[model samples]
Target: MSEMVSHSYPRVALIGECMIELQQHANGTLKQSFGGDTLNTAVYLSRLLGSAAQVDYVTALGDDSFSDAMCQVWTDEGIGLSRVQRLPGRLPGLYCIQTDASGERRFLYWRNEAAVRECFTTPAAEPVLAALPDYDVLYFSGITLAVLGETGRARLLSTLGDARDRGARVVFDNNYRPRLWRSVEQARQAYRAVMHEVDLALLTEEDEQALFDYSDGEQILQTYRAMGVSEVVVKRGAQSCLVSVDDRRYEVPAHTVQKVIDTTAAGDSFSAAYLARRLRGGSPKDAADAGHQLASLVIQHPGALIPRSVMPV
Candidate 1:
């Protein structure tokens, strides 16, 4: 394999929403916080990359107090919010998580009216969409696409095409949620519309099976490769991750955990660390190792954003 090549201080824009997160404790108390698929990735990416690359979050939030707090947390994490839009008379969405004895999580959402749904619909979003092509990498997930609605998804697709034309890499994570879409066919159409423009795909094995009903791992890889994606990583919980770069493939085992306090953000942290390593000139194998390492530590914690102190050096 060739040595890793870094992009030298590249700009990354992660597009998604951050919601009010509540964790129901065993004592029947609720602990409030914030989390989202891409937002969790943004936070972990910022922590891993530090000042090496410019990491910005692109999403719309309400002018409410929760939005204010979320922005502050991002700022503290060294994630840029210059592209974050503050919509008026709107409120961010909320969700509560219930964990089973095995630390597996189930979420209940109240996000039909999230401010981020208008992220690309409002008049102010025009400039933001116009500016997206300026970044070196643009990252988003399935959840990000789901909340955008039809009009917003159309706008995002055009923006992605434009961005790729300007040499920006488009990264996508297949974080599928069946409840978010009207129909499976609708989701498939939306995914297919943008797949051709994707540069790197960070996919989960279960999500691929659940969404497209792929028979096995090979089918998933073949589908993405056929879409012209140059890089693909298939994450399987507690199993080895499969990586395909061009014509070559590699299997990197995940880090084992003794106990899992919570299973949330495992994939998000994995994607973040993987991207961070790649941007720093690490090989695909090294990046996958880093991903598994971070994810291992994350699942041992209670929340999405674990304390920075426990971070691996």
Candidate 2:
């Protein structure tokens, strides 16, 4: 691993969906854009890594206007699209975000038929999975698992085992939304089944308590360690993030901002920079620092994918 592109660099792939997001304006208008957890991470990581790392997105989408815009956006951000699949008849998901006067946002989803839902189980995914093991790092999230459904989930689990066996490091972020699953127990089992294969786990303390009902942050870290994740980051909004790597723990303080326009993707961006830095051979503390630096700016933005100009250069 090398921090500089002139040296060696790693190829990292983020697997998930990108949806057409509508942020309703105060005047009853919709500000349309694209975003999702792993997509946000992919964009942020590409910005953070620049040419030093090869950041690609692995997912399936329909041949529609929204999907076209997404592909263009990824290309503009320098994300490789060699693994993206465009399936016929199927389409990307859409979500609307409505905010109150105080800037609290509410979401409504329409993703039951999204193409990425069957991305893993389709014949097209075979080549993608085969190529995945060659990458240095593979990233996915809880939403990805939930959306993949039963058959896709089973296929993904097997692919992950093969990827891990082939030396590809797996990274997971626990972004738990109750609406995505039928029951908490179902999500818990899915998370536990995949946790052992993860090399790094980016967790939000609040989400952990919601999903697994951990007693404390210590329990969260201990539990992830038991799951065989050597590196675990516990994030709490506006507070310090606790990172456990190897046998050492570091309390990395987050930057304070005057206000948070929207807290969306704060953890996603943090995970991207943290993994990007770590993949570049930067120290764990340095990676944590980079994570916080990127996340601080993200919290100040109005959406999940912020203006690229504001991103760290």
TM-score for all predictions? 0.96, 0.96
Q: Give the C-alpha miss distance for residue 122 in model 1, angstroms.
A: 0.7
C-alpha lDDT of all candidate models, in order = 0.91, 0.87
lDDT of 2 by residue, 1-313 (tens): 2222224678888989889898889999988999899999999889888988899999999988889889999999999999999998889999999988886778999999999987888888889988988887889999999998988888878878988787788889999989999999999999998988888889999999999888878899998888788888898878888888887898988888898777889999999889888877787788888899988998888778778779886
TM-score of 1: 0.96
RMSD in angstroms between candidate 1 and the native structure over all alpha carbons:
1.7
The TM-score of candidate 2 is 0.96
Estimate, for each residue in 130-219, the C-alpha lDDT of model 1 and write its tens digit.
999999899999999999999999999999999988888899999999999999999999988988989889999999999999987788
Over 4 Å off, model 2? 1-7
